[model samples]
Target: MHSTPWSSAHRLDPADQHLRDFLAPRHSPAGDGVELDVDTLLSQKYNGVVELRVQVAAFSFQNSPSSQNAPRLLLDSSTPLNGVLEALSGDATYAGCGRCSAELSTDANGIYSPCYPCLPLTGVRRYYRPGVLTVSGRGYSQLCVLAPPVPLQKILKAPPDKLHRSSAPGSQVKLIQVAAERLHALLSLPKKTFVITIRSHFLCDENSAPLSQDFTLLDLQLPTDCK
Candidate 1:
């Protein structure tokens, strides 16, 4: 195994911190000869998104004559976009304000109402409405969540411009759901390396005379213990 060091900084909400803590070395069994350590160099929220950089280090306690140090891998992992959206959906504080319909703010912990004096002190009800979810990573193509769960057949037949301009709520949710499920399936497999590409096409102009496509390649290296 090879060793690669990675580092980054970003703000994490309570939820993100909880996940980080769960992945820390203290939570895992140290007696198994394998140890995991996750380090967050920095975390902060900017432009309504929580951005952070992290380093995940794996250590081996088993003695080996051939190599003294356990193999290390630096991976570029993004918080699952679908997971974030689902989390927001379940939290009441992040829902749009009842009076203004303004979207609520979110952090590591969950959602919160905007700092406005006119906001009611009570009646902050929880809602199950789905909002727009967008996915973007270093090598992955960006995807926006759709409302109303548009049918795949209809999506194919509709012009790319229509899809982009569609205001229907929950239009892109189905696509994200499928993508997230597929990724989950890939991660569950016993594989050392996983590689896949996600592709999306869009109309180049309003006239629908030509089309352009975006491609994102996902290359991941599973931890030694995972295999």
Candidate 2:
């Protein structure tokens, strides 16, 4: 059996057969060589909180810092929608090709038509169409996704008045600080495993009317020590 970052060698409980089956690898039409399996360590729900931990097999960034010393702000793409298009289309060239022309094929004479396939048609080309011989449009701009963690200590130290405020720009900032503090405190703990407690509440409508607020922890940033 192949070992994944998240997989363990220990056997699972027979009583958890359903969970085992769910974790089993599933075939992909992409091909056996490309078969994909969930790289998850665990997923469970208790009360109103749902928790999940998974390993990333692979990932790509549309825009990355040009150099280690590059300004963090400059690393962001000027146009984010275009960045997404570039990622999905395998960069500007492929995206341009897709937008500007149709697929090329051989003529009865065996002469390649619509220009010979771009030299070194490998890698992403094997899975997707390549860009046109010439530029198609202005092309895609860079973009990125950022999720910074907060420390738990900051939250605990936040002013009482700010915490009580229901809505305000400063209040939002205070909340973020508090969350960071909490996260920092958790990471500082000596335990290898930790459980985070999240509270859920109802959201108000435009008129400030209460709406069902089933809070879900979508993301968490672990401290470098834990990593």
Best by lDDT: 1
Off by over 4 Å in 2: 1-173, 192-227
lDDT, model 2, position 40: 16
Error of 1 at 36 (Å): 14
Q: Give the alpha carbon lDDT tens digit for every residue of 193-217 in model 1.
A: 3221222233455764445433221
Question: Could you report the Cα RMSD, in angstroms, for every candidate shown?
Answer: 26.1, 24.4
Candidate 2 TM-score versus the reference: 0.17
State the weakest 10-residue window (summed lDDT) of model 2.
129-138
Each prediction's whole-model lDDT (CA): 0.31, 0.29
Cα distance off (Å), candidate 2, residue 204: 47
**Per-candidate TM-score against the hidden true structure:** 0.17, 0.17
